[model samples]
Target: MTQTAAQAGRPRTRRAPRRLPYLVRQLGTLVVTLFAITVVIFGLTAIAGDPARDILGQYATDAQVTAFQQIHGLDKPVVVRYLDWLGGLFRGDLGISYQSNGPVWDVISPRLGPSVVLVLFSWLLTVVVAVPIGLYSGVRLRGRRDASLTFLTLIVAAFPEFVLGLILAIVLGIWLAWLPVDSTAVSAGGLFDSPTAYVLPGITIALGTVPYIIRLMRANAREVASETYVRAAVLRGVTEPSLSLRHILPNAAPPVVTALGLQFAGLIGGVVVAETLFGFPGMGQLLAQSAASRDAPVVEALALMIGALFVIANLAADAIVVYVTPKLRDAVR
Candidate 1:
């Protein structure tokens, strides 16, 4: 009887070992996120004060506004309109931009690549520069090196993006004469053709993000350095760089990963001010124009896209953490 029970339990334990892919878990999150997004979109549209009148003029008659509403199907019930929009979304149709007088994709797609390129470079720069600096600072906590880095980071973090953009523009663009000062000089059509155009904006955005990553990494590294395994590794003739790179980094990575993901999402939306300051033609500028013009379709589409990107970035980070961290995988299970 004991032998039979052990055999049965072995199979059960083996069956329980199969882990669900992160993508599957994220699919459920996406569904709930989309539902919430749809509700917000519907509510915003319902309470919106006359997109037609805003687009056309205040002097326009009620008939003109009513006609515009009918044309856009805005006169329909909120649920019906939301369903129609949702269906269109599924069919790869985000509907026309009321402001741009063009397809939503036509307006948004061209700008997406530039934003991606800029943010990707910024993220890369942050990781490359921040990780080492953070590690060194944490390792040399009582030294002048750490104190100086912390002071610089605090100063940088205190400045707003717009202020940073203007300062960089004046210092680098004018004083140093290295890059373009205005966005008009930067060609969004060929992002790589003018890498100089991205430098200012990327750095400006990175200023805000790098500090957080550095601080998080420093704190995590400090804690990690005190851990029993790390202390043992240090005492076992392991080099500081080796222990930090192999043990500390991998262990400290989860928070850094999460911070970078959230930062990327924030950059997507936060780029608006910097984009405006620099005159860079990206989704941020597009969304600003859409909002100013009361273009509900474009605004809604942009909002939804931004939300999707945020959710996807976070999900990707979670998935990465689960894949790389055995502890996280077990927790999920």
Candidate 2:
């Protein structure tokens, strides 16, 4: 009777943490952070230059500039202009791109899908390649294989994304002619039109991120492998594969998952470089082009959109971590 009573109470003590309140608090923080990002974006764009003058060019009369400013509500006080822009966001208006002379969304929406696919492909490669190497290094923990991997990952990590892309372009595209030099030849269908175009840029982005994930995953796996539970499982004569999958992997995954989430932001930056180098016509290339042209509306819209993506990625990661390790629930609040 006592054993039954104790067993029943054990389940109650380990009750899952409430997730709703934690998620609510995180959402609140996300809103405040996004609001702050908007303020900074709007302020920077406001002071950069007069968009009307830039768009209209040097020979435009004062009358023409004034009409353009008034038309875009740029003549309004800065605060009022910001508020109007903020309100417009809620109504799905991203303003007009000075470069395209069209709605900002219409110009960017086409590239959005391809950029997302690029990032996801890059991230998948990072995880698939990094995780196995990290796990193996951790299990080997101070062996020759681990030492060699440490050296190699560091060497790979040292190269900047553009430099790495350039090297790959030279070796694979020029020397061997295995793939096209640039994605310019790809049809309007984007990366899917010729999947080969994605190979170099995708590898470039993944290599840039893989080392960090590998290091973090290795550290976590090593720590988990030393735990009492893992030792006990070993004593029980568990097979190596089963032990790793059942014990170490799950225990080490939460932190790596969180890191992966943060890496998405870095991946976005990589996308910019990769797209520009490869002429992939994704958001990164569009952003670079717009920035060069001093297209304030397009730049501001892209900045906000990118910021939102970063926030959403982190939010999803946090939720996963909390779900996997309920101990983290209190930290969220």
List the RMSD of every prediction in angstroms: 5.3, 7.9
Model 2 alpha-carbon miss at residue 165, Å: 1.9
What clash count goes with each model? 0, 0
User: For model 2, what is the alpha-carbon lDDT of residue 45?
Assistant: 88
Candidate 1 on 1-333: residue-level lDDT in tens? 999988978855345567676677689888899779877975786687668888879899999989988988878887798889989999999988776678888878877877788778778888887887787677657677778888889999999888999999999999999988776555644677777888888888787788988988898888888899999998899997798899888887778877777677667666777777888887777778878878888888888887788777777766776776788777776
Clashes of 2: 0
How does each model score on TM-score? 0.82, 0.84
Flag regions of model 2 displaced more than 4 Å.
1-20, 185-187, 226-247, 330-333
Q: Supply candidate 2's per-residue lDDT for 20.
A: 64
Q: For candidate 1, which ten residues in a row score worst on lDDT?
A: 11-20
Candidate 2 per-residue C-alpha lDDT over 239-284 given as tens digits, one digit per residue, 9 for 90 to 100: 9999888899998987898888778777877888999999987888
Q: Which residue pairs show collisions in model 2?
A: none
- Clashes by residue pair, model 1: none
Candidate 1 global TM-score: 0.82
